[model samples]
Target: MDTIIQPVARPSKRGSYRRHSDEFKRAVVAQSLLPDASVSRIARQHNLNANQVFAWRKLFGEGQQESGNNVCTLLPVTVVASVMAQPVAEQAPACGGIIELTVGKARLRLEGAVDTAVLHLVLQRLLP
Candidate 1:
Protein backbone atom coordinates (compact mmCIF):
# COMPACT_ATOMS: atom_id res chain seq x y z
CA MET A 1 0.00 0.00 0.00
CA ASP A 2 2.32 2.71 -1.26
CA THR A 3 -0.40 5.17 -2.18
CA ILE A 4 0.67 8.76 -2.75
CA ILE A 5 -0.25 11.09 0.11
CA GLN A 6 -0.50 14.75 -0.85
CA PRO A 7 0.80 17.11 1.79
CA VAL A 8 -1.91 18.88 3.81
CA ALA A 9 0.31 21.92 4.31
CA ARG A 10 3.97 22.44 3.57
CA PRO A 11 6.14 25.31 2.25
CA SER A 12 6.44 25.26 -1.52
CA LYS A 13 10.20 25.99 -1.38
CA ARG A 14 11.63 24.91 2.08
CA GLY A 15 10.86 25.38 5.79
CA SER A 16 10.55 23.66 9.21
CA TYR A 17 6.75 23.71 9.67
CA ARG A 18 4.92 20.90 7.88
CA ARG A 19 1.33 20.33 8.89
CA HIS A 20 -0.14 16.85 8.28
CA SER A 21 -3.72 15.59 8.49
CA ASP A 22 -4.91 13.74 11.57
CA GLU A 23 -5.87 10.82 9.32
CA PHE A 24 -2.28 10.50 8.12
CA LYS A 25 -0.90 10.77 11.64
CA ARG A 26 -3.29 8.11 12.92
CA ALA A 27 -2.46 5.80 10.01
CA VAL A 28 1.28 6.17 10.52
CA VAL A 29 1.01 5.67 14.28
CA ALA A 30 -1.18 2.60 13.84
CA GLN A 31 1.37 1.05 11.52
CA SER A 32 4.20 1.90 13.90
CA LEU A 33 2.34 0.32 16.83
CA LEU A 34 2.01 -3.13 15.33
CA PRO A 35 3.75 -5.92 17.27
CA ASP A 36 7.47 -6.26 16.44
CA ALA A 37 7.11 -3.34 14.00
CA SER A 38 10.04 -0.98 13.58
CA VAL A 39 9.20 2.69 14.10
CA SER A 40 12.14 3.78 11.98
CA ARG A 41 11.13 1.47 9.15
CA ILE A 42 7.52 2.61 9.20
CA ALA A 43 8.62 6.25 9.29
CA ARG A 44 10.99 5.69 6.38
CA GLN A 45 8.22 4.03 4.38
CA HIS A 46 6.00 7.06 4.98
CA ASN A 47 8.88 9.49 4.34
CA LEU A 48 8.67 10.76 7.94
CA ASN A 49 11.14 11.13 10.77
CA ALA A 50 11.05 8.42 13.43
CA ASN A 51 10.83 11.05 16.19
CA GLN A 52 7.77 12.57 14.53
CA VAL A 53 6.12 9.14 14.29
CA PHE A 54 6.92 8.49 17.95
CA ALA A 55 5.41 11.84 18.86
CA TRP A 56 2.30 11.02 16.83
CA ARG A 57 2.05 7.67 18.63
CA LYS A 58 2.23 9.44 21.99
CA LEU A 59 -0.38 11.97 20.91
CA PHE A 60 -2.77 9.27 19.70
CA GLY A 61 -2.32 7.20 22.86
CA GLU A 62 -3.06 10.19 25.07
CA GLY A 63 -6.09 11.06 22.95
CA GLN A 64 -7.46 7.50 23.31
CA GLN A 65 -7.00 7.45 27.10
CA GLU A 66 -8.66 10.84 27.38
CA SER A 67 -11.54 9.57 25.24
CA GLY A 68 -11.82 6.50 27.53
CA ASN A 69 -11.04 4.14 24.65
CA ASN A 70 -7.81 3.06 26.32
CA VAL A 71 -9.32 2.94 29.81
CA CYS A 72 -9.68 -0.51 31.38
CA THR A 73 -13.38 -1.09 32.02
CA LEU A 74 -13.33 -4.56 33.62
CA LEU A 75 -12.06 -8.10 33.36
CA PRO A 76 -13.81 -11.24 32.12
CA VAL A 77 -15.02 -13.51 34.92
CA THR A 78 -17.19 -16.62 35.30
CA VAL A 79 -19.27 -17.85 38.21
CA VAL A 80 -19.52 -21.61 38.47
CA ALA A 81 -20.85 -21.97 41.99
CA SER A 82 -21.38 -20.01 45.16
CA VAL A 83 -18.51 -20.08 47.62
CA MET A 84 -20.02 -21.84 50.61
CA ALA A 85 -18.72 -22.77 54.03
CA GLN A 86 -18.66 -26.41 55.06
CA PRO A 87 -22.06 -27.66 56.31
CA VAL A 88 -22.57 -29.64 59.53
CA ALA A 89 -24.94 -32.57 60.23
CA GLU A 90 -27.92 -30.37 61.16
CA GLN A 91 -27.07 -27.09 59.49
CA ALA A 92 -27.31 -25.61 56.01
CA PRO A 93 -24.26 -24.39 54.07
CA ALA A 94 -23.39 -20.72 54.59
CA CYS A 95 -22.19 -18.62 51.67
CA GLY A 96 -19.87 -15.76 52.65
CA GLY A 97 -16.44 -14.27 52.25
CA ILE A 98 -14.15 -11.76 53.92
CA ILE A 99 -11.73 -9.27 52.33
CA GLU A 100 -9.50 -6.98 54.31
CA LEU A 101 -7.41 -4.09 53.03
CA THR A 102 -5.34 -1.55 54.87
CA VAL A 103 -4.22 1.80 53.59
CA GLY A 104 -2.02 3.60 56.09
CA LYS A 105 -4.32 4.15 59.13
CA ALA A 106 -7.50 3.29 57.23
CA ARG A 107 -8.86 -0.25 57.45
CA LEU A 108 -11.52 -1.80 55.18
CA ARG A 109 -13.31 -5.08 55.69
CA LEU A 110 -15.89 -6.49 53.30
CA GLU A 111 -18.12 -9.45 54.09
CA GLY A 112 -20.38 -11.44 51.76
CA ALA A 113 -20.95 -10.48 48.13
CA VAL A 114 -18.16 -8.33 46.76
CA ASP A 115 -18.47 -6.27 43.62
CA THR A 116 -15.15 -6.51 41.83
CA ALA A 117 -15.85 -3.33 39.86
CA VAL A 118 -16.33 -1.35 43.06
CA LEU A 119 -13.22 -2.86 44.58
CA HIS A 120 -11.24 -2.09 41.43
CA LEU A 121 -12.31 1.56 41.45
CA VAL A 122 -11.52 1.80 45.16
CA LEU A 123 -8.08 0.30 44.74
CA GLN A 124 -7.32 2.47 41.70
CA ARG A 125 -7.81 5.50 43.94
CA LEU A 126 -6.23 4.00 47.07
CA LEU A 127 -3.11 2.33 45.73
CA PRO A 128 -0.26 3.95 43.82
Candidate 2:
Protein backbone atom coordinates (compact mmCIF):
# COMPACT_ATOMS: atom_id res chain seq x y z
CA MET A 1 0.00 0.00 0.00
CA ASP A 2 1.22 3.57 -0.94
CA THR A 3 0.75 6.53 1.46
CA ILE A 4 0.27 10.13 0.30
CA ILE A 5 2.37 12.91 1.97
CA GLN A 6 1.27 16.58 2.20
CA PRO A 7 3.79 19.33 1.34
CA VAL A 8 4.75 21.83 4.08
CA ALA A 9 3.47 25.39 3.81
CA ARG A 10 6.00 28.12 3.00
CA PRO A 11 6.20 31.49 4.72
CA SER A 12 5.54 34.67 2.73
CA LYS A 13 8.59 36.43 1.26
CA ARG A 14 7.49 39.83 2.66
CA GLY A 15 6.47 40.66 6.20
CA SER A 16 3.56 43.03 6.91
CA TYR A 17 3.99 45.95 9.33
CA ARG A 18 1.01 48.12 10.31
CA ARG A 19 1.31 51.88 10.74
CA HIS A 20 -0.81 53.57 13.42
CA SER A 21 -1.87 57.24 13.27
CA ASP A 22 -0.88 59.78 15.93
CA GLU A 23 -4.54 60.21 17.03
CA PHE A 24 -4.98 56.47 17.46
CA LYS A 25 -1.70 56.17 19.35
CA ARG A 26 -2.70 59.02 21.66
CA ALA A 27 -6.08 57.37 22.31
CA VAL A 28 -4.43 54.06 23.20
CA VAL A 29 -1.96 55.79 25.52
CA ALA A 30 -4.80 57.67 27.22
CA GLN A 31 -6.73 54.45 27.68
CA SER A 32 -3.70 52.88 29.31
CA LEU A 33 -3.67 55.78 31.80
CA LEU A 34 -7.22 55.10 32.98
CA PRO A 35 -7.64 53.90 36.56
CA ASP A 36 -7.06 50.13 36.98
CA ALA A 37 -6.01 49.79 33.34
CA SER A 38 -3.35 47.18 32.46
CA VAL A 39 -0.95 48.02 29.64
CA SER A 40 -0.58 44.43 28.49
CA ARG A 41 -4.31 43.82 28.69
CA ILE A 42 -5.05 47.04 26.80
CA ALA A 43 -2.52 46.19 24.09
CA ARG A 44 -4.06 42.72 23.73
CA GLN A 45 -7.53 44.21 23.42
CA HIS A 46 -6.32 46.67 20.76
CA ASN A 47 -4.22 44.10 18.91
CA LEU A 48 -1.01 46.04 19.70
CA ASN A 49 2.27 45.16 21.33
CA ALA A 50 2.71 46.24 24.97
CA ASN A 51 6.13 47.71 24.14
CA GLN A 52 4.60 49.73 21.30
CA VAL A 53 2.01 51.21 23.65
CA PHE A 54 4.67 52.16 26.20
CA ALA A 55 6.79 53.75 23.48
CA TRP A 56 3.81 55.75 22.33
CA ARG A 57 3.26 57.03 25.87
CA LYS A 58 6.87 58.15 26.10
CA LEU A 59 6.76 59.83 22.71
CA PHE A 60 3.45 61.55 23.39
CA GLY A 61 4.62 62.70 26.80
CA GLU A 62 7.74 64.24 25.27
CA GLY A 63 5.63 66.04 22.69
CA GLN A 64 3.33 67.39 25.37
CA GLN A 65 6.25 68.59 27.45
CA GLU A 66 7.83 70.36 24.51
CA SER A 67 4.53 72.14 23.83
CA GLY A 68 4.29 73.26 27.50
CA ASN A 69 1.21 71.13 27.98
CA ASN A 70 2.77 68.96 30.69
CA VAL A 71 1.19 70.91 33.51
CA CYS A 72 -0.70 68.71 35.96
CA THR A 73 -4.47 68.91 35.84
CA LEU A 74 -6.53 68.22 38.95
CA LEU A 75 -8.94 65.34 38.67
CA PRO A 76 -12.34 65.37 40.38
CA VAL A 77 -12.20 63.79 43.83
CA THR A 78 -15.05 62.52 45.99
CA VAL A 79 -15.19 62.58 49.77
CA VAL A 80 -17.37 60.00 51.52
CA ALA A 81 -18.54 60.46 55.11
CA SER A 82 -18.64 57.35 57.25
CA VAL A 83 -21.57 56.63 59.56
CA MET A 84 -20.90 56.55 63.28
CA ALA A 85 -22.92 55.21 66.19
CA GLN A 86 -22.16 58.40 68.16
CA PRO A 87 -23.96 61.73 67.57
CA VAL A 88 -22.53 64.48 65.28
CA ALA A 89 -22.34 67.01 68.17
CA GLU A 90 -19.84 64.80 69.96
CA GLN A 91 -17.65 64.26 66.88
CA ALA A 92 -17.86 67.78 65.44
CA PRO A 93 -15.04 70.22 66.09
CA ALA A 94 -15.75 73.19 68.36
CA CYS A 95 -13.92 75.54 66.04
CA GLY A 96 -11.44 75.62 63.16
CA GLY A 97 -8.59 73.19 63.85
CA ILE A 98 -5.10 72.40 62.65
CA ILE A 99 -4.18 69.79 60.08
CA GLU A 100 -0.88 68.24 59.13
CA LEU A 101 0.06 67.65 55.53
CA THR A 102 2.97 65.78 54.07
CA VAL A 103 4.10 67.21 50.77
CA GLY A 104 6.88 65.20 49.21
CA LYS A 105 9.67 65.02 51.79
CA ALA A 106 8.47 68.09 53.67
CA ARG A 107 5.88 68.20 56.43
CA LEU A 108 3.59 71.22 56.95
CA ARG A 109 1.41 72.09 59.94
CA LEU A 110 -1.48 74.34 58.97
CA GLU A 111 -3.38 75.72 61.97
CA GLY A 112 -6.83 77.29 62.10
CA ALA A 113 -8.48 78.62 58.94
CA VAL A 114 -6.23 78.12 55.93
CA ASP A 115 -6.11 80.79 53.24
CA THR A 116 -6.80 79.12 49.92
CA ALA A 117 -4.56 81.53 47.97
CA VAL A 118 -1.65 81.05 50.39
CA LEU A 119 -2.07 77.29 50.36
CA HIS A 120 -2.20 77.25 46.58
CA LEU A 121 0.98 79.35 46.35
CA VAL A 122 2.77 77.16 48.88
CA LEU A 123 1.73 73.98 47.08
CA GLN A 124 2.73 75.40 43.70
CA ARG A 125 6.21 76.12 45.08
CA LEU A 126 6.46 72.80 46.92
CA LEU A 127 5.26 70.39 44.26
CA PRO A 128 6.92 69.78 40.87
Name the candidate that leads on TM-score: 2
Q: For model 1, how does the per-residue alpha-carbon lDDT over 98-122 read when each residue is reduced to its tens digit?
A: 6677755667777876666798898
RMSD in angstroms between candidate 2 and the native structure over all alpha carbons? 12.4
> Quick one: best lDDT, which candidate?
2
Each prediction's TM-score against the native? 0.38, 0.44
Each candidate: RMSD: 16.1, 12.4
The sequence of per-residue lDDT tens digits that candidate 2 reaches over residues 1-128 is: 99999998998788688988987888888888877989999999999999999899898783353222346645344343444555644554424556566654687777765766798898888666
What TM value does model 1 have? 0.38
True-structure lDDT of candidate 1? 0.72
Task: Report lDDT (Cα) of residue 57, candidate 2.
Answer: 85
